[model samples]
Target: MKVLIAMDSFKGSLSSKQGSEAIAAGIKEVYPSADTKMLPLADGGEGTVEALVEATKGTLFTVPVIGPLQEKIEATYGVLGDHRTVVIEVAAACGLPLIREEQRNPLIATTFGVGELINDAIERGYRDFIIGLGGSATNDGGVGMLQALGFQFQDRHGKEIELGGQSLKDIRRIDAENVSPALSEAQFNVACDVTNPLYGETGAAYIFGPQKGATPEMVEELDQGLRNFARIASEDLGKDIQNPPGAGAAGGLGAAFIGFLQGELKSGIELILESVKMEEQIKGVDIVVTGEGKLDGQTSMGKTASGVAQLAKKMGVPAIALAGSITEEAADLNEIGITSYFSILTKPMTLNEAIDPDTARQNLQVTTAQLFRLIKAFKQ
Candidate 1:
């Protein structure tokens, strides 16, 4: 029998690759002669760079860049096995976790480090870019990034505006004359999952500002700043950036990519699956196994597991999910493509115990072995 094992990171426990390995071990215990292919998967979020790097046998590079609060930090990016495509997760530099809870002010956050990452990759001769837009701590309309890339946002007096979301309202001009010339030769595929517009009740500021430490008053202020930036971009750059489905993602960085970088926004799962050539790998596998740390209603909403299962279903293969925990809402996943699901826990345990790497690994292996044993018995 042939099996394909693909798993997302188990959060505090196992990484995608590690989870896949544990599943593979279990399957081997039950079907020693079984052929299994292990793959690492991730949605275009926090673990994106690591997952894609492992999946494609890519190399990782670390660089020092400015953080959300204008502090210096080290961030990592990846170059795929092809040596052409570079993957960057915005969270690496300006993510919420980079700052303390008390310091989570979206008003002063910046994505300057994201731009610096791109610039560094470009200098390294990479022209193909996959930018993962998730977990950002900024609401600066991406002006901070644009500034790092040599796009000038100037005040009425022709002086450059300061960085951060708070400075969006001071822009009187947009200039692209000094942008990195190599940027024109680059192609950007942005992984964006949300569809919030740039400004409004459901937009970037109003929707995500609070999570980034904005109070109600700050949300309104940030919203107006985004509106002003949008208007200025429209007038000076000839781009209507505020209305796109994902323009509000990562605090308006989506708009910046769309308007200035000529980026194509796509579903995060779709982008990652394509990058890893998932469909091609699933072709002749007898069964596909996939899962994440948790399976909930959101799992079916463009998550890694759902993406894998849907593809397997289309190809006439059964897809089973194994998760650390399963919620009642996850039952709906059956309607999508998950043929069956299992939780890897053997007995009740505290959250800390459940997340212990060795414990989780053992659970995954034992659970997988038992499931495959039943399958083998039925086949006989």
Candidate 2:
């Protein structure tokens, strides 16, 4: 029998590759002659660079860049096996975790490091880009990033505006004349999962600003700043970018990508799956196994497991999910493509015990063995 195992990371316990290997070990215990293929999976978020790099045997590069609050920091990016595509996660540069709780102020944060990473990759001759837009620490309408890339946002006095959200209202001109010339030859496929617009009630500032340490008053100021930036961009750049589905993602970085770079925003899961060419990897597999740290209603909403199961279903393959924990809402996953779902725990334990890497590995192997044992018996 042939099995394809593709599992997302189990959070702090196991990585996607390790989780798939554990499942493969279990299947081997049941049928020593079985063939299994392991594929690591992620949904274009925290683990995206690691997952894609591992899956494609890519190389990782680290560079020094400016952080959200003008501090210097080290950031990492990846080059896929193809050698032409570069993957960058916004979180690496200016994520919320980079700052202390008391210092989380969106108005003063910046995404300048993100543009620096992209510029570095371009210098290396990489023209294809897959950018993950998650866990940002800014609401500057991407002005900082644009500035780093040589897109000048100038005040009425013809001087470049200062960086960060607080400076958005001072912009009276947008200039791309000095942009990195190589940028025009590049293509960006942005991984964005949210649909918030650039500025209003459901937009970047009103919805995500508070989470970045904005008070009620700060949120209002940031929203107005975004509105001003959008209007100026429309008049100067000839693009109305504030109303797109994902324009608010990564605190208006999404708008910058769309308006200036001509990037396409897509579902995170969909983008990652396409990047990995998952359908080609699953062909002729007898059964597919996929899961994550947890399975719940949210798992059905374009997460890694749901994305895998949906593809397997379209190819006439049965998909089984194995997770660390399963909630009542996980039952809804059955309607999507999961033939069945199983929790890897065998007995009650503390959260710490459950997440122990060795313990989780053993449970995954044992559970997989038992399930395959039944399948073998029925086949006979």
Scored by lDDT, the top model is: 1
Clashes of 2: 0
TM-score versus the correct structure, for each prediction: 0.97, 0.96
After superposition, the stretches of candidate 1 with alpha carbons farther than 4 Å from their true spots are: none
Worst 10 residues of 1 by lDDT: 162-171
lDDT of 1 by residue, 115-190 (tens): 9999999999999999999999999989999999999999989999988999898888999999978999999999
Score residue 300 of candidate 2 by CA lDDT: 92
lDDT value, residue 77 of candidate 1: 98
Candidate 2 local lDDT, 147-202, one digit each (tens):
99899999989999887899998999999999978999999999998999999999
The residue-level lDDT of candidate 2 at 175 comes to: 90
State the displacement of the C-alpha of residue 183, model 2, in Å, after optimal TM-score superposition: 0.4
